[model samples]
Target chain A: MPKEKKIRVLIAKVGCDIHERGALTLLTTFRDEGMEAIYTGRYQTPKGVANAAVSEDVDVIALSDHTGSLPIIAEAVLAELKKLGVTDMPIIAGGLLTQEDVKVLERMGVTGNYGPGTPMDVILTHIRNVAC
Target chain B: MEVFLHNLTGIPRVDEAISLMKARNIRGLTRAISIVENYEEGRDALLNDAFQRASEACFTLGFTGAPGVGKSTLVNAVIRHYRRSGKTVGVMAVDPTSPFSGGAVLGDRIRMQEHNPDNGVYIRSLASRKALGGLSEATKYALYLYKAFGFDVIIVETLGVGQDEIDVARYVDVTTVLLVPGYGDTIQMAKAGIMEIADLFVINKSDRPGADLLKKQVQNILYMKAEKERPPVLNTIADQNEGIDDVMEAIAEVRQRKALQGQERHRKRIVEEIRSSVLTRLAGDAEPHLDEMAGKVLTLSMTPIEAAELIIRRIQKGCLEDDEKNSI
Candidate 1:
């Protein structure tokens, strides 16, 4: 019999994105789902986020992007992760991301881009699947 | 599938993590904090390595008080003060773990969100899992991690103060026990363990009616304890941002006096931690059989006192069994 595992997700903010209600919501949501959520708070740079991901030993990296500074911030974050030799860690984006932005993030090697209004159930399922 | 510590396939080895901590890389710091919090095997060795390499910084402080005393808000004010002076602060706000979920409500961070955008502050809400004294046993390790991470000040706010929650005294440089205005009389509140552990006293919500009497009682109690200098007592209406500076000033004075005394807090903390760890290990060895004893407890086969004694005896018995096995 396999024991149930607690999925550990490191939630980080990119750029100067100060709005993190979405991140906080997801933190409680993930915790309620029996996952361990480590929040990095706000105003994290790309390298900072990447460093936290590797250091916390989180199963996934979820970037909370509300900066509306497209591509550059997300691009810098992904590039940093790769540069640090974190090639295959599942990366997810949450908060106010549009369909077009999600496509951009996906193109940049993000495993999932969860936009606003994406059902909580779907996000939770995706996290569970990717974490396992 | 994993039994100990959060694991990552690509996670750097302990050496790399140490180097990163030296470089003040956020990831390395994060890794060290997580590893310590999880109580992974060889954690002491890893932490000792970090501690040996760490510079003397981040004079540790602890705030202890009853629930709903605005301790977190007071802490937030302190963070703002430190950030204004361009000093980095690492805060560990420990919350009670839900017995069912083993997760934190984490509402402490809500009061702290204002500092979220400031690069000078890092706030972590840890769930105290079965740890007594209003904090996880791992909190001391996390403080080491934070000190190595270069925070100028590391503040540990326990979930709430109770009769047995004086463990903060063993760990922090100076402990300020926060109390609201309407606590019982000085005689009522000044129990043995609680008063001695407090390096300072804060009566928050000074705007309330009973504030003066509470402050006077604390002062009188301190006056009677003639063996040492009395700890300074102050007032703060944390909600209105009132008297925050006085608290900081009081803390600064305490820190200065402690420094003049030659960093005895660190030495004391080490001895306390050693004592705590050894006892905790013995308790852990005894704890596994408590499940069976608990069944006996349910069925009236054994009284609770008997069950406790059985667990206590098992600790020594387990050690003897290991000794015999090693001899063979």
Candidate 2:
């Protein structure tokens, strides 16, 4: 019998801010849920994230940015994704996104907007929904 | 088909494969590690075949310390040192389990973002989830697999707070215990467990106040236990990469000493492994019947003590055949 291939995810935190609690939390959550997640650490640029996504060939790219600069970073990341021809890959954004910000991020092609106190299961379910 | 053949043969064409690994070929190393880690599934044959083909160029180091001790920073320093020497390093950082979510809080990887560009270094963050020893039991297996894949150094950074973290020392040739100054009574809490296993003690954040005093205290404790062979202690500020060279040198020295002292620690490690294995197996065997037994006990069909006795007896009877085989 052939073993099932695990879902691969790339969890990256973009922008100059050093806060990575959300990203780390997501990485661990994915692993515990039996998913293969490649963590890009913290303080990554949009290009770095896009490059990693292309190299890793991850099913999902989860961006965790706690710094209030998500609107700009999301736009840059979406632009990079489009440029790299990776628009098919789901880009989920979490961490400190307000309702209005979420709406804006969605328009920019973000798949999910996760805020503080959001359950990891919710993120996992969302990834499964989008990637599977 | 090539991967399958590689798995069957247990031999890595070391020069070619290691060069591939050193060039940041993550896919190659990842595949090789999977093969080696699953040795019981007959990948050992392939690894043995690869063994003659691979270089004997690997060092395995274990890092453990309390939370907020700047272990990630120290690990970053260590990675930078190895990178400067043109050696490929694999870091496996084990993070604490999130109590709320039953997942890992992989915060350590976030703190060491600068090293991402160094293609020679592969940093993996692992969550310690319900694993008794604080490390994923597969970690030692993973380390050896990395070695087989030709990583020059594999650093296992573990969650530093519990018994599981201390168990990490048994698996590595050198274990460094990281500490920070003025951690208050947290030092006292960890002293008994961590002090015993540390191959070397590192006082990181040396720029902070009380660093010297903390070092003195640790030194004094080691002095008191000098009868049992004390590990050397050093101070470093990992954020700035201070004193990392000295730490690495000390680690190398310890590795050499262990090589010379070979099998002494290995035998002890085997004994510990046996103990843990037996307990885990016993638990697995007992768990399924636990609810049934509890129901019986609740109904007064059997006392709680009697239920436990029955479980032990069953285990004993089950092992009797193996015990006889051993005797014969």
Candidate 3:
């Protein structure tokens, strides 16, 4: 029998963004929702997150950027993923983002622009749909 | 940069995957491990090929200890030492699966992320998946694939464990147990499970108080076993990379002296593997009928033992019928 597929998500932080509260919250939520969450901790480079996502074969790349480097970090992560030949890898961004930042990330094909105050259920539902 | 095998529609044929893996295609290796880990179709065949390609060149080392005991940090340090010697390394780090959600946060990679850019090292995190021994079933199979790819050293780090959970010892060449000050005292050290299996013991965070006392306590235990070569107990501040060289030297010494015994252990491991596979098969076959068996016992139609016997008999009969049909 084929085993049930569990949605694997890689939650990471890039650059000097030492903030972990948002990233850790998402990790806990993923686990509670029955998704395999791989946390890379803080101080990751954009390339580091991409390499990890590929190695882990995660279903989604969740970038936590409270440093407001969301657009730049998300762009780098996407570029890195593209360089790795993973054009279709889903990228999601969350954290203290302005509307302008969200628009920029979405233009780059990143989805789930979740900022603080986004309900847990909403985030979970979006991932379930995107991961499939 | 290569596309992952799973990203493609169907599972690749064993030969196709094997060739890609032989060429050191990281994506192919990752996908092959996933196949074995998830027990997908063609898993056994893939593993058969992997086992045939395995050689003794890849040395597997295991690191196990309690939670927050610096297992991952020590593993990171060891990987650095191995890389400095220009050796390729593969690491399989196991973390506990949440029994309720059936999910896990595989955070061991966090400590070892410095090697993320280094192609010479591969780190895969495994959730224990309810395996009581603090290891996942996929670990041994993943080792086969890692060996086939020709890593110079393979490391298996078990989830933070308590006094027992010595299963990692059965799968690796050397089992290094890490202890910290205040973890336990003399009687805790004398416990028969985790402490007894170590070919080497490391007192990590040795900069803390009570480190020397812990080392002496471990030595006292080793002294009781006069006939055997005493496993060395070393001190280290793993995060700072202090005393790591001594640990590496001790591992080499243990490996060299235990060469003959290693062969014997390998043979026993083969038997254990086969036994586990068969048991898993039987358990899978038995699962579907368990509810009915329980119902019968609840109704008092049969005792639990009788119900168990009936289920076994039915399974045997079904197997015999299948064999007869195949023969015809």
| Best model per TM-score | 3
lDDT string for model 1 (B78-134, tens) is 888887887778788887766676654555655676765444566676667668877
Each prediction's TM-score versus the true structure: 0.77, 0.70, 0.94
The CA root-mean-square deviation of candidate 3, after full C-alpha superposition on the true structure, stands at 2.6
List runs of model 1 lying over 4 Å from the truth: A1-29, A38-102, A111-122, B1-9, B54-58, B83-88, B107-122, B147-151, B183-188, B191-196, B205-214, B226-228, B237-241, B259-268, B312-315, B324-328
- Candidate 1, DockQ to 2 decimals? 0.18
Query: What tens digits encode model 1's per-residue C-alpha lDDT throughout A1-132?
Result: 112234678787776777879988988887777666777667766766665555446788877777666456768877777766667788777777667886887788776676678899998888888885
Off by over 4 Å in 2: A1-10, A17-41, A46-59, A65-90, A94-110, A113-124, B1-25, B28-57, B163-165, B183-191, B224-229, B270-282, B297-309, B312-328
State candidate 2's TM-score: 0.70
| iRMS, model 2 (angstroms) | 9.1
Ranking by lDDT: 3, 1, 2
In model 3, how large is the Cα lDDT of residue B226? 60
Write candidate 2's Cα lDDT for B1-328 as tens digits. 0111021111235444444444545544554444432223444444554445544457778888788888888998888888787887778787665555454445565566676544566666555544556575545455655665667788899876743357788877788988788854535734567768888899999999998888888887677655435787899988887898999898887787668666787687668766765665587678767998999999999999999999988878878978999999
**Scoring model 2 with DockQ, what do you get?**
0.16
Find the candidate with the highest lDDT and give its number. 3
